[model samples]
Every structure is written in C-alpha cells, then in structure tokens.
Target: MKRTMLAVAGALLLGACATPSTEVGIALFNDTVQPLMVTGNTGTKVGRACAKNYLGLVITGDMSVEAAKKDGKITQVASVNKEVKGYALYAEVCTVVTGR
Candidate 1:
C-alpha cells in the first residue's frame, strides 16, 4: 500500500512537469507584397506567460510577445507564427516572427 501511494505521487509530480506544446497551423499573412529585406528567422522561449492553479484558474502575460519582437528585431510585423507549451503547473510559449 505504501509503495502504491508513493508511485501515485511520483506519477502526479511527473505529470505536472510535463509540458504540452502546440503551434499555429495556419499562415499569418495573405498579401503577395515582397519585403525589401528579408530578415532571418528567429525564435524565443518565454516562460511564466501563463499558469494554472489547482482550482483550474488561469493567468496570462505579454512577456512572450515582447521577447519575440526583441529577438526578431522586428519593427513592422508582416507575419507571425506562435507555438505554445503548457504544463499542469506552469506554461511556456514561443513566438516565431518573420519578415522585415
């Protein structure tokens, strides 16, 4: 019985740490206008962007957006792709920005 309880606790802990991630499946832009300068692709990992409590409450922030823009060095956003990683206890989201 003790061993079973310990096993369950371990499983719960691992589950809480497991992060489920996803990305935007669709394109961000439809216009055909070409950019004068094409910047290289860039990605940034942002954490604490969201969180879930034991009661299923959620909170979010703009850290991911700011980080992505800074990393990409983008002034004018032409297109954007977003990837989200979520955990039972915490969450991390990444933004992939492209274009000039």
Candidate 2:
C-alpha cells in the first residue's frame, strides 16, 4: 500500500511540473509544419527543406543545444502552425535551439 501510494503521488507531481514549450520551439513548430499541414507541400523536398531550416534555427540559439535537448524542450517540433512562412520563426528558433 505504501509503495502504491508513493507511485501515485510521484506521477501526480511529475504531471504537475509539465510546462509548455519555449517560445522558440513553439514558433519554429508553427512556421515549419504549418504550410505542410494545411495544403501538403508539392514535393517531399520542399517539406524536408522546410523542416531542415527550422531545425537549423533551433541549433543556433543563445542557449546551449545540450541544455534544451536535455530538458525535452524540442518536442514541440510537431505542433507548428499550418499556414505561415516560418522564416522569422526560423531566426528566432535558431537562437533558442542553439542556445538551449
């Protein structure tokens, strides 16, 4: 019974600590995935290129890449907008991604 109670409490604590993605990740996700999600890119290359650019942005942020990766902050990669250019998002994303 004690063990079960501890497990439940632990799960609840961890769940409560969950936070939203950083501004940079959110922006990148929106820009890169938005176009593809809305109309489906004409070619795979276009879609891949978009993703690559966004990823590049994340890698060049002010934070250390290792820290961001460690914090699981990059998971927002899939939650982007469905109809946006994402270049501005990319520049900011780069700083966050790299910096983190």
Candidate 3:
C-alpha cells in the first residue's frame, strides 16, 4: 500500500511539473498569404528562416517574411510556407518561402 501511494504521488508530481506545449512538430502550411502566381515549369526556389521560443513564453530570432523571400531570390512571391519543429522546453519556428 505504501509503495502504491508513493507511485501515485510520483506520477502526480511529474504531471504537475509538465509544461504544456502547442503546435509542436513540422507544419507544411502557411500562416499568412498574399496573392501571387505559381506557374508550371518555372524554376522553383525555397527560402528558410527560423525563430526560437524560450520557455514557451519569450520568442527570439529572425523569421521574417522578407528574409525568406530574399533567401529564395524571389522578386515576386509565388507562395509562402511554414514549418514548426520543437521539443520539450524549446522550439524552432521556421518559414519556407517558395517562388519561381
């Protein structure tokens, strides 16, 4: 009975200490968008950018839309995409800007 009580207490402690995480993992979708042309046979390009999340509260780093566009050498954006990869206590929010 004592062992069972200890186990239950341990479980409760661990559960209480656990941090809530949201939107963890890769997401191949856009959070924002603009009107742009995506044509076939055109040269495809991709730009990547990342932002860091601290303690699930503070966010630091650069994941600018313009930066992604520049990285892909895109004058006129065809489409914008995003990817989010994260783990316990930290996260990396990334953006993939695609263009022709």
**Which candidate comes out best when scored by TM-score?**
3
Candidate 1 C-alpha lDDT tens digits along 2-99? 99999888755754544433332212111122222233543243212222222123444453544556666655545555445444444444455553
lDDT for each candidate structure: 0.43, 0.32, 0.58
Lowest-lDDT window of 10 residues in candidate 2?
43-52
Task: Tell me the deviation in Å of residue 21 in model 3.
Answer: 7.6
- Using lDDT as the measure, the top candidate is 3
Per-residue lDDT for 92 in model 3?
66
TM-score of each: 0.39, 0.23, 0.54
Q: Pick the winner on TM-score between candidates 2 and 3.
A: 3
Q: Candidate 1: lDDT over CA atoms?
A: 0.43
Task: Supply candidate 3's per-residue lDDT for 60.
Answer: 76
Q: Choose 1 or 3, whichever is better by TM-score.
A: 3
* lDDT per residue (tens digit) for residues 34-95 in model 2: 22122322221111111223323233223333344344444223312322234322323221
lDDT of 3 by residue, 1-100 (tens): 9999998876554433233333442322213333333544344788767787645567776888788877788766656566655454455666677776
- Tell me the lDDT of model 1 at 50: 28
Model 2 stretches astray by more than 4 angstroms: 19-100
Q: Candidate 3's error at 49, in angstroms? A: 1.5
Model 1 per-residue lDDT at 7: 83
